[model samples]
Target: MPPAPQAYRPATALLDLGPTFWDPVEGANFPGTIVRYRNDRAAAEVGLADLDDAEWVRHFGRFAPLPDTLPQPLALRYHGHQFRSYNPDIGDGRGFTFAQLYDRAGRLMDLGTKGSGQTPYSRFGDGRLTLKGGVREILATEMLEALNVPTSRTLSLIETGEELVRGDEPSPTRSAVLVRLSHGHIRIGTFQRLAYEQDEDGMRALVGYVLRRLYGEESDDPIRLLDHVVRRTATLAARYMAAGFVHGVLNSDNINVTGESFDYGPWRFAPSWDPNFTAAYFDQTGLYAFGRQPEAIHWDVMQLAASLRLVAESEPLIETLQTFASHYQPAIADALLWRLGVVPRGAEPDRALVQTLERALRTTAAPLDRTFFDLFGGTVPASYDAAWDGLRAALADYRPRKPSDHPYWQGEPCAMLIDEVEAIWAPIADSDDWSRLHAKVDAIRQMGEALA
Candidate 1:
């Protein structure tokens, strides 16, 4: 009655997919391999950890039963606007959804595999994803999550023993498939597919189904459904700006209608707050740039609103669409303030605060001493006073007689304060002095346990 505690589907799905979605990619049938296996404890909090190798491969890869597990293949239908042009043929071309499970903390999660193998949707190209794609996605997830952005979590990457040919990068390089967990895989294009075809009955069925599954209500009403999607989308854009992330491809297919950040292809963080920064290799026009993400999100939302117009009034829908600005600014400001360790001024827009906020991105100019912003709680060396002071000096209005006396980190007894972060994400290679940094991470974990 309360949504089955996780990403559980009706038993009817078992009967629906049958044996098709259960077929695994034989050998290196996929350009990539499923090698490494890892779990995310933080992601597990959202009921994701349970979809381990055994449960995941069978469902996602469409492999036959090796043991007790759920049979849910990864296949969905959707259409999208590619480079400002509408394209009707697009879906899970080379990936599949394996299983939805409860993580360690009991949150609903979907485990899906990319570059797994060929699917019904594979058009003309080889049904595979490149190793570099996996690496880029891993970095995207790490950087965004560290900044507290809502995004899909990259769980594991496998380097297939075999080599696959690709156009870009190097030939016969390596091959890999990534296992990522997310809140939902459904997208706006999913509904638009049928809606645009003038299939009114089909659109009604799809919208109603999505509402019951994703929005937690059984509503045939299009207004509530559209508004719910708009609200979630507004928060998503706000979070993106807050974390300085750019989803290089904000096409309708890539924009998750459920509002969960999905599809990590060609995503990048602002190296230094350059608005035009793009992560995609072929983004010639910079449609999905860092500064344009909010606009891009709205554009995608409008498309969804347009599709929903088949059943809903345009007047009320326009108001819903207009509310994006009302919600995004405050949320983005809060995120910026938190990242800079500045106390929030509250719900009203803080013009002075906005100007001061620019200093955080300017790490070199004013040199806010002892700067720091970790998604996790502070504890690592980056969380130390040295990091803090480096950040404060960057602000415009500040009068500090001594370099170390900046207000941001110049409070109270110096020795009494403690900053603890569970893990530091720097490379373990040499410069990290891996052994030493590891010990620090362990010590922080131990300290956290003791405090708990």
Candidate 2:
């Protein structure tokens, strides 16, 4: 049967907050290009599935504001700590929030861009993105979503006919503009900027705006907001660990207020259960390694607490900050159980199970993701091995989330390992063959549905 048409409900709540938070900006003009990809599933959620290719490129590619959306794009102002060093010079240098709208679930979503153009924050660099960068982001978000991590969605990728010079990759690389749909673009760095400026009035206004827009609460007290953000951040960190993802950069600005992980750059899934596993080639100290993500997020939370001091008491803020450790441990267990497709027994038992699994994976140097797939949704060859007896015994108390008759249980587990991702991109880099990338995305979506 054909489904009922979705209703269009575009919104612009963020723009209503006032011009103090952002600067009006224009997107760059690119040479005539074509839409490389479009997330129709996500588009349907936002009542935009009927848009033709021309409309898609006109709005997303050409950066024309959507009907009933924001009148203009906004370059949000923010500051972030880079590598533990305070940097006041950072903002949305290359991208801006193009529009805001409500999805089918009534959640306020931001239509933000990457490589859209230069803004006030574009400091001595071209506001551009490479086609390879857009491709990598698409892969990263897809894999993370399939693994049940709270993340942004890559909505569109349009290949702009421009050559960009980059030091890290092949110079004069093909250019593209990417758009990301997310819960919100407000970051921990957003508050940091307010605090740095000593703008108590601005801080108070931001606190009120965030509470009303994102949290759906009207609270004059900032402590409650801090507590909520800390809990969300801890849960996000736990999800990353369960997914074996290293974010590479744990800067305050990169951490969103909604606790939804976005702005993927140099992200990698760990091949094995190594806490010290790093993703970025430039991360010499491994400060934002796979294992240290929780710590880095906690540090970012403390910074948020510090920023809230302008409106809230430090005593309560500090107390809220202290709960992150307690929140994270149980969150890790729950996340792990979710990935394993099992109902958790309880807090203590779940923690013990997680510890047991981690110990087994580390001691045997097992492939992290493959190990989860091996034990979950039924059993693979690893289940019968004596080495996994502890995990088997632990699983005796839990039940499968999926039915035993599910077809996914009968096949090999799908994975998005580094080697596999590069292999998918290799054909495109060499011969413009995108069939592998499309196939991989389809397989990842299937995995997500099976796990669901």
Candidate 3:
């Protein structure tokens, strides 16, 4: 059955937190342009399904704050460690939190923008996003969500009729504005900034606000908060591995407090189970590679632990940090079972199964997505390939999520490889053709539904 239409319930909880956390700013005025894409599925969750192209342009492209929402947009302030070096001079330079609202599930959601406009934090640069960058983000979020990775959703993308020069891509690319729907915009860097300023009181208030809004826990203890973040971060790392995704940039600022992954810059999915695979062109040392993601996330969590020292005891925080491996290993096993679409056996047997699957993948170097499709949903094997013998034995004691006749199981696996994503955007880049992009999104949505 179709889900009931959701009603928009605007709120201003973040605004109520006061001015120290962010700076009030207005969105940039773009030349009158058209709405290029609207995520109606995501829109429905926030009661925005009926928005016309003009309305989308006004709200997203023109930076008009939603009525009855926050009175003004806020460019958040944060400090992050970029490539293991503490960079205290960073914040929301281009985008801001436009509004907040409750979704149909009663969870608080934030409507944040990217490439919205320049703010006080915009240091010596034009605040605009390339049209191609916007397109890539939409694809990244949609595909990640379909794979059941905890991620932010792309709400809207609008072309803003401006030419911007960039060093990474071709010069003078078209400009755009992107709106993202996320659980919250708070980041680990948010706390790090407070620590850097020696604002112990500010850190306490921010922690309280996060607990109330996100975790719904009544405890104000910093150790409790650290424990929660560690668990969530472990699960997030495992999910990325299970989905074969590389976030490219795992900086503290990019890691949200909610443990949901967002801000897709140079993201990619693994073509095969290569642990050293990297997505970003400029990651010279491969700091955020496929295999090192868990380590990177753990390091970021330790930074969070370090920041919390201003308000909490260091001993408790360090003890909590040590629990990461215990949380991460089990989470990875569970996520792998989820990807394989099988019910888990006993704990011992499940762990052994996970280990066997890992060893097989590493030995064969099989394409991760193809391997899932080959084994999941009760699809019969065409031959008794010796390479898959361990995997077949691993599945012997588990049941599939669907019958062998499920339609999605009958065809080739749907993969969002980087090459395919570029092909989807090539037509649009050349002649403004968006049919392929639209079709790809539809295919991804269908796969998500089938998995559910």
lDDT of 3 by residue, 218-334 (tens): 877888889999999999999999999999999999999889999988999998888899999999899999999999999999999999999999999999999999999889988
Model 2: per-residue Cα lDDT over 1-452, one tens digit each: 43554577888888766887899999999996679889988888788889999999999999888998898889999998998999999899999998888887778899999998899999997999999889999999998998889999999999999999999987888899999999999999999999999989889888887788888887756887898898999999999999999999999999998899999889999998899999989999999999899999999888999889878888999998999999999999989888888887888888988898888787888887667776775243644567778877877778887764556556777777778878987898899999999988988887787777
Cα-based lDDT for every prediction: 0.59, 0.88, 0.88
**How many clashes (backbone N, Cα, C below 3 Å) per candidate?**
38, 0, 0
Instruction: Name the top lDDT candidate.
Output: 3
TM-score per candidate, chains pooled: 0.73, 0.97, 0.97
lDDT (Cα, 0-100) at 429 in candidate 2: 81
Can you rank all candidates by lDDT, best first?
3, 2, 1
Off by over 4 Å in 2: 1-5, 378-384
Clashes of 1: 38
Residue 357's lDDT in candidate 3: 85
Ranking by TM-score: 3, 2, 1
What are the runs in model 1 whose C-alpha is more than 4 Å off?
Answer: 1-34, 42-72, 102-107, 349-351, 359-452
Displacement of residue 309 (Cα, Å) in model 1 is: 1.2
